[model samples]
Target chain A: MNDLGWIDAALTAARPQAVSALLRYFRDLDTAEEAFQEACLRALKTWPQNGPPRDPAAWLIMVGRNAALDEARRKKKQTELPEDDVLSDLDDAESALAERLDGAHYRDDILRLLFICCHPDLPAVQQIALALRIVSGLSVKEIARAFLVSESAMEQRITRAKRRVAAADVPFEAPGAPERAERLGAVAAMIYLLFNEGYSASGGSVQVRVPLCEEAIRLARLLLRLFPAEPEIMGLAALLLLQHARAKARLDGEGNIVLLEDQDRGLWDRELIAEGLALLEKALRHQRPGPYQVQAAIAGVHAHAAQPEDTDWAEIEQLYGALERHQPSPVVTLNRAVAVSKVRGPAAALAMIEPLAQPLAGYFHYFGVKGWLLKELGRADEARTAFDRAIALANTPAEAEQIRQHLDRLKEGAQRKSGRGSAHPAQS
Target chain B: MLYAILCYHDEAEVGSWPKEKDDAVLAKRALVTDKLAAKGRLGPVVRLMPTTAATTVRAGREPLVIDGPFAETKEQLLGFYIVDCASLAEAIEAAKGMVKDGGGAMEIRPLRLFRPGTTAGALAAESVAP
Candidate 1:
């Protein structure tokens, strides 16, 4: 790899450890961030000449901590600035620090940093924005583009989040087992939220926000490293991989939404599917089926199907049934109705979701499914009304367009029948 | 390390309960506190009045006092417990022991330690000197 490429990879790999350690020393977000930046600048200048450090994280931590201290001393006028040779000399100290960080200190520091970003006091949006900024090291502008918000608004959101985190006074100590479990749950939820933000990108903008999905997958892999034996973590990672493998066929070339049944299965990434299936198998063998594991199992069924008709709808329905019992929600039932339509018929599917209307009144998928069932039953007028509601509640332009196409089909059927009736008027 | 377990609950639901039911719930919490005290993990336990009796003051040139909690949410802060433990895990166990069945939520936050000369405004010149 080129020098810049190597430097970039090293920095990305080192950020979690180096920044976590710096945050420990400074006890403040802005100060820790400033120190990390200075270290990065020094790396850009010195790495090309001195060659990469044996432990990049250790090198960054030592240099960043000293730089911040130097700035502090300079502000007080108590000591002169260090000579260039002294500032850059980190061979012995970096090795010692690296040795110390290899112990339990490494995992705790990174996990604590992640927990702070997803602290309960912050809203979900702020939690996501903060994690993207601090953990993933995305620039504010880059994060703004991914969320489809303006730069200034995203900046304010991040600033406010940082202020709240500092005020909240998160602990610097390693969490105990129970607390680790709680924090792990929080982190998993945050990662899922991040993936959804990318997955649900609306209108013609599906490709613009794909980086969020990749980042979430990356963080999930990191979590798996920390808790390798935890089945749910494995399940979570597998679920994201299985779903993301279909990104290529999720939308057509014209940026329109494509239903899974109609999508070209050839476009799916087999490598990711294989990895997901392996993880799901291992997780299921653990005999602890959580919501994520059940969902991954369902996705695994889809991945194993080579053709659309080959999909095992019966197993999917059972998995959804398990999911409903595990974490009951109206949305789960709505999804199960689709499987029911395949296994049974449109009548049973319609009956299944008829009771969900009151609870899912504003839900777009509710109306979409209702419209499809109504259309299948030859109740065109009711289906048209349902489609109108679905369009009104559509989250993105692509989703709205998908419903509009269905409406057009109904319109054509009506026009054909009316034209036939007029041509037979003399016989009548 | 000292951790604060802040308990939040639906105020309306709690307020409508009978006095006997409230006392019974409090009795269960007291049992948990007694257990923690035996282990030397318990600290101060404080229960605040309802949000109806709360006030907020915004600092500025002139302070603005709002007559409710800082923000309106589904759950309101009803009480808190301070627990001293070796690590966050112990503190969480203590908090979980006290939580009632069907309770709303508990937020665990660590309290900052007070050191003499670590203020952001004050430069730690002596410590920084090479």
Candidate 2:
């Protein structure tokens, strides 16, 4: 079919691969993106009647590079071109890029994956913004609108992000075979970070940037296609899909954070959940439990629960224990405590987190969980104090508001038992 | 008349859609396919992977091998449906039913040549209610 829609889809699917390859060639984000555009223009003029090339990305990459070079040569005709040595510092970088890109298993080009993943320190939000703008080939205005920022402000933000990427040391040495695992890990983390940035639990609709989440999922799928057998890659893809399945249900009409138990399960996307569950099953079958697998297993547990009351808290606690073993952060332990409270009692979970106070002192989720545990124990005054801290530390107004609602409920409960001074007696 | 309805759409736009949206589109299309299948008129329906995975072997001086789809055109030949319809009007109606949501191209052409193909469905189900 020579339909424009078909052509558009072909160009869109090939964009990241084509542009990323061009970026590696040109060593400039703007130049690569511009070249990709020029190449698309040519493809439009020729592809319809001619039928699609065997590989769209390889086609676009070859065409874009030539078009960019032709334009560059024309523009610099009067001026001297870059000395071949300057642009072709290929002795080390060529091998390194090849090693990394090859590990991703691209069929057409060996050194054509992504430059953005190599720039590691762009901060979460900026990393995502840069990826969307450069590698994803989204317009500055479109990115700004996605992030709910002004167009010019977004333009400056992207420029700054690009400058930071430009400043980072270009990698040279090809990583060893063992380092291939680490290489894929970095790229996977980058994609997950992008998803989390788009999946902020608060600030309502304003904070939930749909494009970022979608883009991250897309990247994860691309990564999975390369290393389909690698359990962790499957888990990474599954985790993003599983988490994103509930994107619409995670926030309320007011944009307040809705905990899993309270979320409208009907709002969840069954298709994504099914895909995620299938991938997670495949990952578990590999029996190579890693951090991503552990986390995805946790999400799988949530998705598998038909109702909040049906959740297997014991299984969840075990998964959290597994996660803590893999990652071993106080945050994981804090998450574990939620399950602990459900399986055992509030006192046991409270004891579990008591030592974590020093480590999770300023974290919002920590206090929120602690406050809920305290309220369950009928330690109303302490619960109120913890909630106050949670509100103060919350990431967004919606989060703060959620804690405020909790505090209000606590006050209402205390008022109902007016004369009971500071506590409640045991049921026994 | 036996017809091959070729499906085509912009890859980028479809790829960008959230998983839930993609599922909804499939769910709607199932409504159309069920009726066709019930009548024993539906054939194999397939959704091709991204064009990157495609390999085209151009039969030339030495049968040249290329990297992507055979025809790098605007929209892609994403998938196809085979239907046994009484007339072109019936086939067009089937094409329209398949794309009820209305964003892709479905080119319906009468098959000049024929072969027995593997059936994806048993085609023994009762009527698919509207």
Candidate 3:
């Protein structure tokens, strides 16, 4: 194979195992990261000429481990360096390492690595930054661009996080069963953050950060594999799959924000939806409801609908209620209010969200949803007020436009309802 | 080749250790060191003073020049051991026995080694640490 193809294949195949092994070898985040980069450079130079290896991950890990060891030895000036052939023979060495690193090893290294990056000690922003940097192989520049922050700032943030990990002296071992269960919640939250970071990509002509989304989904799947019996993990994976199923329909020809109601159902990825729904059904069958499962059930309700109007808003509202009990937050309540408006009339949703005005004041989505509910209730003044707040807090032009459309519709509805005495003229 | 298992203990616990127990604690550590020596694992082991005798320096800005360790931490670095181990896993396993029940925590960290040559060689290696 050509160099590019070979490099891509090697990276794709070896990434999980190599990273896992490096985490095992170095224990320090920065050292492990540096070691991996060294191994990759060697692979690029040698792999194309030698063709692909049998066990790419193992090959990369072995080469990287030896390289790290070699560098360490050279640092101490302790002994002569090993021969090149030994370092380059990754294909043979990887199989040996793979045998040694089976089930427990996989958990201790890769999954635990995920858990470490999302350690509760690190701030959420730092958690996402560290995960993107260490796990996804994204450079600080790439992560900075994705975050729309300065490269130097992002670099400093990542460095500070690594130092925290080092200073905190977080365990390098795979935590025991009790510890794993406790920390799993934090890990799942981090993965979802990764997905949302990509899912909620701000303005500009670019599409979503497909890799981040894909990697988050991939991590979720890996987590499911580890905890096949855990309903929440299953629900989380299902939720992402279902949400991503609509990726194609999420944008129009002009790359604008297509509301859930406006999206073309036909364009949705049925394969993803089916897989998502199946996983959701399996999770629900466990009869052990949790936040992720409830949210997944809500998504499942939407996925089952043939048209937007066919949505089971009553069930969705119920699922949202269960979700609130499991993991209540202002955001969940705001979303549930939308379902409330669809099922119990706009007045009910308006009542549901009225108490949330204080906490959700600065949140754009809160006002946007509130505006829609008020507009539905024929309360044009309050609806416009909410819409204005939403527009003011809008993160992008697209979000602003979506809120503006609601305000326009509200004014038009008022004008039609009040006949010729309407104070405000509706504008297109 | 050299790994450090830095022991972090509660300062209150260390403060309460009776003066009569000092030599006994040292004797216990000496026993542990002797056992490690038999297995060719011992390198350097030292018991540090309480966190009161520690200093911290940040990379930038006028150093806060704190009198004590980083913070009013319940866990303070009590002691450390440098062990020669083949791998990180080995080092961690070796460090596990260093802590007594409800006494302290040990942090096993591998020392970094930067070489004059091919240090750059490892830079782009893509060795992922999980």
List the DockQ of the predictions in order: 0.01, 0.12, 0.01
**lDDT of residue A147 for candidate 3:** 76
> What is the CA-based DockQ of model 3?
0.01
Candidate 2: stretches off by over 4 Å:
A1-7, A44-54, A80-115, A167-176, A201-205, A415-428, B1-13, B18-130
What C-alpha lDDT, on a 0 to 100 scale, does residue A304 get in candidate 2? Answer: 79
Where model 3 places Cα greater than 4 Å from the true spot, the runs are: A78-101, A202-208, A416-428, B1-130
Per-prediction CA RMSD (Å): 23.3, 8.3, 23.5
Window of ten residues with lowest summed lDDT in model 3 chain A:
A419-428
lDDT of 1 at B19: 41
- Measured by lDDT, the strongest candidate is 1
TM-scores for every predicted model: 0.70, 0.76, 0.69
**Highest DockQ against the true fold, candidate:** 2
Number of the candidate with higher TM-score, 2 or 3: 2
Task: Look at candidate 2 and tell me the lDDT of residue A65.
Answer: 73
Query: For candidate 1, lDDT tens digit of each residue in A169-257?
Result: 87877788998898888888899888878887643345326678778877877676556557788789889888888888877888876
lDDT of each residue in A1-428, candidate 2, tens digit only: 41355566567677777776666667666787888999999999998778667566767877787787677767656567655432343223333234333533342221223435346676666777777776666788987777777999999988888888777744433445565666677777778888877887333336566677888888777666545567888789789888888888877888766767777888887767766776777777768899998888888888877677777889989999999988899989988888888789789999999999999998888888888888888888899899889888877786777788778778777646433122111100
Q: What share of the true interface contacts does each candidate keep?
A: 0.00, 0.12, 0.00
Order of the predicted models by lDDT, top scorer first: 1, 2, 3
Worst 10 residues of 2 chain B by lDDT: B121-130
